[model samples]
Target chain A: MSRRPPVGVLAMAGVAIGVLGLPLVGLLQRTPWSSLGATLGEAATLEALRVSAVVSLAAAAVSVMLGLPLAWVLARLPFRGRALVRAVVLLPMVLPPVVGGIALFFALGRRGLIGRALQNGFGVDTLIGTTAGAVIAAAFVAMPFFVITAEAGLRQLDPRLESAAATLGAGRWTVLRRITLPLLAPSLAAGATLSWARALGEFGATITFAGNHPGRTRTLPLAIAQANEAGQPEAAIAMSVLLIAVSLVVLVGLRHRWLAPRRRWPEPSQEIPSP
Target chain B: MSIHAEIQATVGGFAIRAAFDAPAGTCTAVVGPNGAGKTTLIHALAGLVALERGKIVLAGQVVDDPARRRRVPPERRPIALHSQHNLLFPHLSVADNVAFGPRCSGLAARAARRRAEEWLEKVGLAEAAGLRPAQLSGGQAQRAGLARAAACQPEVLLLDESLAALDAETRTDVRHLLADLSATRVLITHDPVEARLLADQLLVMETGEIVQAGAPEEVAANPRTPWTAGLLGVNLLSGRAAGTEVALDCGLALTTATPMTGPVLVAFSPAAVTLSTAEPHTSARNTWEAEVGRVQPEGDRVKVFLGPPAPCRVWVTPQAVGELGLEAGSRCWASLKATELTVRQA
Candidate 1:
């Protein structure tokens, strides 16, 4: 009842430290204290581990590359349908992970929208049971992270820099590469990290659409799910630990060491810092 | 290098209509109060904003004209702007930020960096080449911003409040730097002192329209409108002239050095007049008696407005105000030297 401990403040602090912190603490505590090396040395475990790394990295890269143009349009352009477009782009952010998987299946499955057209045009089939499918699914859930981060970065920038460049005789592509891209670096790094974390832990979407296949579409999350179903709860816990470790290393590196060092340095703070 | 433009632009809730002939190497100061569309005028000319009507001719190239179906985007225009915020790429070092303009302009990267170093050195910022904008002082950032704008070697430089964001100390130094910069410059500023120091001509605006424009001296000596008169620090008296002088119905005669023989515009600054409470015995040329209606304290001086016997204004220092023991409603006499009086036919 003290004035310092407002009800809402206590509730928020309780939720932040209790709910989010407990799982992270338990995962670290139960991470196979004795058999970590043996679990890591298993062929299946290592394969799942490699798949998670490659697929997540690939998905993060693809999301960053593709999300950039969409983010630019949303953040920079003043088109009539911009509001609607932004809402549509943000759908994956709020959509249930399972629902997102179902939607992905409808678009990229063997009998789905793009699957039929791609097959007819190029005599190709959807790699739904392969490694690429895992990447596609991971990208699906994670793409919104990159787009949202990049769009926010773009929104904070002054388009006048590009305009000034244009007046200096630079074309659109030149301005985008030299001005917008460099300016968006910190946001881009954060976005890439977020998407990577999301992709590494993708389960529902990868299972429903990519169809879990060992050495192919099956990722670390699927391995963990399968291990738990087979009554190996400890192994599931271990794989989850591995996944969380990867996320922590990557996310912390990006946010602290890679993206934030130069920013925290105090240099040319003017009459006003950026509003 | 030269630009002649007549453009009318309407954006959202505001519209700007401006026309000016900027000869190469002449910096024109477009001076106005806040929200008077000075920035919009520069943007339209730079092709940053589209014109609703009229043409923009830069070095004989038709940059934009809605009627002619010609619109060159800003990137294609031979111009550069030092933005108000400096907009120094926070991620890049001072050298890199300056190099960006030239590199974007298609100069080879190494060549662009070399040019950037040269410009940075010119702007007195070569020592800070490796430093980020956050590391530079406000004045250093301002210099770097100018160096970056000049690195592109723009034919027309539009400075949109480039120095306004700097602190007073930094702003004073940048003002001198801008004065020495030789380019086809257009400065959009709220400071009359800036306009006087940097521009060869002044264009004054109010509510997005040009109210008056001319050489600073001309505008100061003879302003046609109330807004321009206020801007140029002159008291404008519009009246029908019959001979060497025009008599105000307030019963005071406003004398001019040149005999204005017909309807005319006459102006004089308060600073040019001498004030007294006595009828002068000597020939002080133009003397008038009027009741002091208001005494406005301006800096160290007081501007005393005379309501009647004849409405006129006289300026004296606070020391003089106390020495004369002047007050509102106190009867006073004022004088204008005949030579200081300026007249022009309206």
Candidate 2:
């Protein structure tokens, strides 16, 4: 609606665009193209990539599956200490990932609460140094994203929908599956994407819980870190390129389909009746 | 054992105690002012709210009763309620929201979807089947809601101010649809006009009590209470007319524009009449010199009802009554403006 911008506005725009675009520009410039082919051919690199994919996908699925019910409970049910329960779910989001890792290690490392029971019953000594451990750690940090977003979706849903479904003869469970879930799908998709992204980026928690084991739990991020530690800058940069390229593709596609524009339902328009 | 039931429940801070016998075909309207618990009564009857101290018995099933500890959850209740809020599901297509209950009732998925399509056609929303609720207009949404309720085909239909949200024109259409699809309908409303247009009987609620209940004509004919008269806007007559003003047999004279040949209603506002103790001559169209039959305090004003035959009434300030030393049998002159008078056809 405005006709023109002031000189200050132009200056601010220049600064903002420069700040926003600098990282992508630098990544493209710094990408080691010649070394990319050789580094990608490395068996360790391919194995690490496979491990990352499996761990991140498993973590995303677990997060969504668990977070949905937790979100519904927090948003819809009334109980004593509900606020406390909600706070517990949200703790991972606020805690530093390293602290999250330490917390995970204490619980699922050999002597932890359920860890002891698992060892006694199933003879599973610990969750550390395994692909499942990396997934558990990744899921721990990623689940909060799903819970918070899904809870917002559940909170915003009108109860009338369920009521209307009932009048048409829907029982509670039927309404939930047929009416409630589909209605909340966009939010669910958004939450799933957030969890996926978070899981893919998991470094500290995976390192602490699963350790860096090639072909087992050493994901792309761990591989890149190991390359850097070994002073193989070329290999690290090549893997970084692949990581950036793939993550960008996943992020863009998920965003375009689920997290993009038009997902935000417009507010009901109020048309003033003519007097 | 009948479809009708006694409904009692408390919601928020309000309590509802009503014995409603919704006959097989008649539409019973629960008409009351705002906050009169009409909707609560409807919800209680629909099993939406738990009873603090009553029961809803329908077709021999004690759906809800606090004392007997018999309560059917809303989902299990045989009755259907089209909620006042036009609650269409925003995410699902129009067809899916309608199909919800049947599928929930254990119908196969295909059968449920078919029933949903049939109801959509019935509500004239078949064209919008693929669209979400956010796509429908107000009336369409309302129709969809009704379609969803009717699709279940429950024994008792409880509409809780269902038409209150629609525009005037759409309301007429929905009301027509409702009348055609009529079952044992318990309609909750605040508008007497809507009540008269839609219902065979009226249940008037005042505060938490049922002040009056009967046919609309009967209730309109002899309003047992003053609130009922005000709500129905009927000429409440308990007096006789003489000349330009009718004197209520209750000792109150009402001025009217039409000259009464015999018995008539001389209607005028309480504000139109000037009350004075002195019988001074004035240009007022009707001047009534009557002894104060009774002086009752109403808010800041006192309603003065004069003697029978010329039974006339006027409202004067409490301060004025005190200053004039007004009491029963005290002589007073009342004057009313001709422009302020209204005549009923009857």
Candidate 3:
């Protein structure tokens, strides 16, 4: 409750700020401010932006649709090997993006494992080297972020709320729709936004698995990489600034509204006091 | 509606087996110590827990039977469990939380809200219905929880220690409110006073079994177990009975108006015993010579603990204690009428 900050904590805080802020500062310093609009309006850049928006939104949707039930199972249900299943769900979060991409490639690429089985048995094409493949790769890398965040939120919820609802004549599905989901809305939104941001910036996995193409799988990050490799440094710097600005707007804006506890009421005793 | 249930279940290593029948429109209080499977029994009746073996019949309908392999989920049961903590939905206003049950039952939104408002008025929390649960006081929130549970008009209401968490003043207020309800209720409580005040019949549980069951006064006057005796704050002396006299284990004989045979439990209120400094020559059926072990003031009266012929406690007025100058080491004769001792076959 005191305002005094220890010297050691202040020093560590300074280090954290430096580590987090220094890269953005350098990127902003190196950006081509005058040519930003023209560069962003170019054909290749616009195509990549459109593809990035579609793929990232799709990935975020997939994460939320699949992650919510998985999160509920992880947080509320008791079963054998739950820890092992949770570990597997989180593996992609810690895995290198390129390694994840390579793994996805082998599993879904043409002539690889299940990919070949599908081509021979069902006459269906592989997911690799397409926009759908890009979405999958992005989802594979970003889903762990959604699952872990949503699970933590679900774990913090009061389970008695659901039980209370059930006793009040609401069945299992009704209780979930009316009570559990409403309570988890904020965390679910935050997790989806985080997943979207991660998917938007995905480079290694998307390129390795989807094989960046001009009008198909080439997302914003892939286009930026191409610009850098082709010696168009100014275009790459401009895109980096755009990505940083988008991430900041999303993460900071949501954190302020949905995550922070609203302090409108003056009475402190009214929050049930946790026990 | 009457509830007839025989629940058998095991959780972890703790096993519980109990059966009870509540007559139509009667309030039955299940009174017990903690870990006595009171909550477990309530859950079993609510269909939240499975029965290993038994049958549950409610209003002449079979709700649970292990042999038939039929089980009803909690949501399908015509019962409600109200608890002290309220467990109100945090994201919804008080009105919405109360209306939730009716809405789930397929009522129109306006009608459900009207029902919630009516129940809120009954609980005297109508003014707070628009506010969230967190905005209400502890007593007010519990009232809302009651309204929420009652709005659905279930066949049976189960109160699971719903008034235990309140402070003394609020507990009294809530208990008084509960007394006004005319529903078929099964109240689980540890307090004998609450059980006595609210229940038409009393069911006493000890270690997952129904140790005693009868009318409140009957059970209170004839507690056969130590836990029930302690709960009722009465003196219980176990002994062998022959006709109207009990040869107590403490080397004394007590005469009772009721005839008993074989093993018996003798119970008498502390207030029934009168202390005398001199040996009484009165027509009292029983008299014991006791040494005053401790004399402590209790409000307007004094509680005098006596050395055993049986661990006896006597409550006397402060004036009487002072008139006799009673204290530790003081010797006296404790006498009671034959009708005061309740003799029950054990």
Best by DockQ: 3
Chain B: TM-scores of all predictions: 0.82, 0.68, 0.86
lDDT by residue (B1-346, candidate 1, tens digit) is 7889897998777998888888888889887778888888988988878999989998899999899799988877888888776878777788988998888777898999999999887666777888888887666777788889878888889988777656666567667777776678988876667777788888887788887878888777777776677666677776767767787545567766677676776778878878787987656578877778889997677888878655556778898898777898887677777777677887
**What tens-digit string does per-residue lDDT give for candidate 2 at A1-275?**
87877899999999999998888788778778876788799999999989999999999999988889899889989999998998999998888888888888888888887788889999997789988999999999999999999999899787767766666666777778877888788789889988988898889988987888888789999999999899988888888888888878877877665655564455444432311
Error of 2 at A56 (Å): 0.9
Q: How do the residues B56-122 of candidate 2 rate in per-residue lDDT, one tens digit apiece?
A: 7787778787898887877887777887776777766778778766766778879988998987886
Show where candidate 2 strays beyond 4 Å. A6-20, A256-260, A263-275, B99-131, B165-174, B236-346
* Local accuracy of candidate 1 as per-residue lDDT tens digits, A39-124: 86789888898888889999999998899888988886789988888788788778877888888888878789898887788777
lDDT tens readout by residue for model 3, A96-133: 89998898878878868788887888887878777889
Best by TM-score: 3
- Supply the global lDDT for candidate 2: 0.77
TM-score of chain A of each: 0.87, 0.89, 0.91
Residue pairs with colliding backbones in model 1 are A166-B74, A166-B75, A167-B74, A267-B134, A267-B135, A268-B134, A268-B135, B291-B308
Count of residue pairs whose backbone atoms collide, per candidate = 8, 15, 0
TM-score, each model? 0.85, 0.78, 0.91
| lDDT ranking, best first | 3, 1, 2
Candidates sorted on TM-score, descending = 3, 1, 2
| Candidate 1 segments exceeding 4 Å error | A1-16, A23-31, A254-263, A267-275, B104-127, B136-140, B161-182, B189-199, B211-213, B242-263, B279-319, B326-331, B337-339
DockQ versus reference, model 2: 0.24
Q: Which runs in model 3 stand beyond 4 Å of their true positions?
A: A1-4, A121-123, A257-275, B166-182, B241-247, B251-262, B276-307, B317-333
Clashing pairs in 3: none
